[model samples]
Target: MSRVRVHNFAVSIDGFATGEGQSLDAPFGHAGTRLHEWFFGTRTFQQQVLGKPDGSTGADDAIARTWNDGIGAEIMGRNKFGPQRGPWEDHDWNGWWGPNPPFHTPAFILTHHPRPSVEMEGGTTFHFIDATPQEALRQAREAAGDLDVRIGGGPTTVRAFLAEDLVDHLHIVVVPIVLGRGERLWDGLEGLDQRFQVESVTTPSGVTHMTYTRP
Candidate 1:
């Protein structure tokens, strides 16, 4: 069966995946790019996101490079797509990733207000739908075919899937920061460790990468 996986997901030491006060100007809220500083210098991020020729190729880069491997589709919360709430006041707001999104596959956006599917460059198509985690995974798995479906997240969505035991593999990067307030990734997920065989590795970047794989 195709696996449901999450990769390069960054969380603060306190478990907050993203800070509060999200808006057009502040995509990650007050946290800004602090959560992702470890990833920014990776060769994978440099080539994939920044289109740069040179980047660090160490332990961090080694783990970050697997983010796109065998990913046929992605499921992200509406917040990860953009900061808009309620009815999408603007249809012109495609996404934060310009025309050529990095996913290069069908990307499903979980939302209360469903909108028309937007096709972008690089074979990335955004489909917005209102459904439970199971329903959304069904659609994503179908679109994913034989390849794995990636759960691209914004804490709430990831927590929902985790609670349901739908995720097969989870890679969480624990950045050493303390965000006093934000959307937490581990809320209501007590005893989550029992579900997976866990292992951790601390890279020289001072971030700990934890992998949870279902046994």
Candidate 2:
């Protein structure tokens, strides 16, 4: 059976996935890109995100490379799509990832205000929907077909899916930083770890990688 998954999701030591006051100017907010420094250093990130050739190799790169494995569709919060709140002012704002997004599949955006689907280059189609988590999963599952659906999150989205117990595979990278105030991944999620078999390992980059998968 196909699965709903979260991959390479970063969080701070204080359990913050992103800092407060997220904006178009500051996507990661006060925490900045400090949360993703380990990712940027990986060869997989250099190739996939930066479209570059040279980067470090090791456990981090290996984990980064798996972000796209067997994933046919992506579901993300409106916050992950952009920093905009309320109704969107700019209809032309495709996303933070330029024209050719990495997903290369149907990427579902969960929002209260829905919009017409935007088709982008490299086989990525942005479909906006206002539905409950279960409803959204149904759409994503159909779009995914034989492959798995990835929950590409900004904390809130992941929390919602996790709350509904829809996620089957979760990969969280814990950065060794302390963001005193930010959106937390563990809020209202007590005993969430019990749902999956978790395996943790500290990488050479001073970050711990945790993978939670159901048996």
lDDT of each: 0.94, 0.93
* Superposed model 2: Cα runs more than 4 Å off: none
Candidate 1 per-residue C-alpha lDDT over 163-186 given as tens digits, one digit per residue, 9 for 90 to 100: 999999999999999998999999
Cα TM-score of candidate 2: 0.98
Reference-based lDDT, residue 141, model 2: 93
Which residue pairs collide in model 2, if any?
none
RMSD of 2: 0.8
Clashes of 2: 0
Best by TM-score: 1
- Candidate 2 has its poorest 10 consecutive residues by lDDT at 42-51
TM-score of each: 0.98, 0.98
